[model samples]
Target: MKLGTLVKPLLITGLIIAGPAMAAPSAQQVLAASPVDDIVERYPAMMSEGIREGLKRSPQLPPMVADTIGYVVSNSFRAADIEQQIVKNLERDLSGKQLEAVEGWYKTPVARKISAVEIAASDPAAWQQMQAKAAELGKKYKGTDRARMFERFDRAARATESAVDTTIAVQLGLATAMAAFSPDSANYDELKRKIENQRNAIRGVVEQQVYDSYLHTYEKISMQEMGLYIDFLESGPGSAFSKTVTQSIQQAITDPIESIGNQMARFLAPQK
Candidate 1:
């Protein structure tokens, strides 16, 4: 999906993961309080540069994006703890696919992709093209308040894409860390399978939590959007069209998350 489309949904998802307070501290505070400081302290040479780079990039982000980065950093630290749990509980080393899966989680692929898009969006020509396309879509769906709906959809799509990327990064990162620290001496394939199993289990839980949080946030946003749409419809000339477009946008916003939950459930199912 287009990057603009995913922004809102991704932001909504990030907000959900961040919880009600959503009170992530500034980059400075995060640097001080982050558990990764332990890792950095231990492997100063290996990690300090990367941490600094991440921090440098952190300030370039929009406030919402910066908060999401904090969430990612916090989650990465938590993944380390979970890795220790896996080592203790499973009594086996992580390998291959399993390793990849865990490492995927913290890598922030979604954010990276959005970063690229934001760059593209910055170019005047590219920005104009996007607006032109949006206008065309608006015209095509005329009389249905399609213009505003199109904008929301474009934003939501970008957000969803980013969220999915972030999800993958977190999974992969967790898997990699688990493998590095695991004590068992199983072969790569066996280790990998076990790691994948564990990763899948952990991801299933994370996905469910994220999904629930997203639904709650979506409900609130949808209600506000609907209320505003109704007000426009009542006072303005586009009431019926506005309602139809709003409903359609809500469905588009929800369908992907629902599908993602279903897909995750399949992976999470009990192995008989």
Candidate 2:
């Protein structure tokens, strides 16, 4: 079957996975329950409008891109579970009002603003303009640590973007595998094996890329921030970390991203 033929079922699988569960559902069951029309209807007005415009303007962007973009817009718009976990993690260090303020941004009309930005970013002219602006900023701030920091930030941003793309590929492969497992299919077992193999391959690629790229950048930025804090503590009346404790704490925080990367690999890796 064509890739577009799988889009509806994949979306249904997403809804089931994202929804509340009495009992765990398999990928196939989730695909069977998905309502494609309902999924399309749930998209935000701005997204629908933008998708229409994109197809008109590009005319060559594959139908799959439109479908994938629609799915992304829909999922991101309603990713409450992911957002809630992010908020819960942040709340450990933030006050109640601060948490509320952060959550409030998600409810605003910001998605439309972001959609516009994405549209602009996709345009060749606009992308060139952005690169030119970046060069201008680099020249203006040359010779300062701030410029160095900006360069690091740019690198981190690119790494994060790569991480996101890898993640999407992993998710799509998993979804496709799940969609292929139907009881009526005579070659169900063979199809399942193919799916599992693909899932494993994609998961491995994503996990390694995330570790080598984003995780390393994260460690650098984090160490830079911690250095400022350490300098303050050393210069002031109080110091929280003795040299031994400082080394221990830095390792403690930095070690977990590696663990997280491993866990992601295990979670996405297909069962033998």
Which candidate ranks first by lDDT, i.e. highest? 2
State the lDDT of candidate 2 residue by residue for 135-177, as single tens digits.
Answer: 4554554665653443344332233333343334333333332
Clashes of each: 40, 0
lDDT of 1 by residue, 55-102 (tens): 345333344533443343433333233323323322223223332332
After superposition, candidate 1 runs with Cα above 4 Å error: 1-168, 185-193, 198-203, 223-272
Clashes of 2: 0
Candidate 2's C-alpha runs over 4 A off are 1-61, 76-79, 92-129, 151-272
lDDT of residue 263 for candidate 2: 39
Against the hidden reference, what TM-scores do the models get? 0.22, 0.27
- Candidate 1 achieves a global lDDT of 0.36
TM-score of 1: 0.22
How many backbone collisions does model 1 have? 40
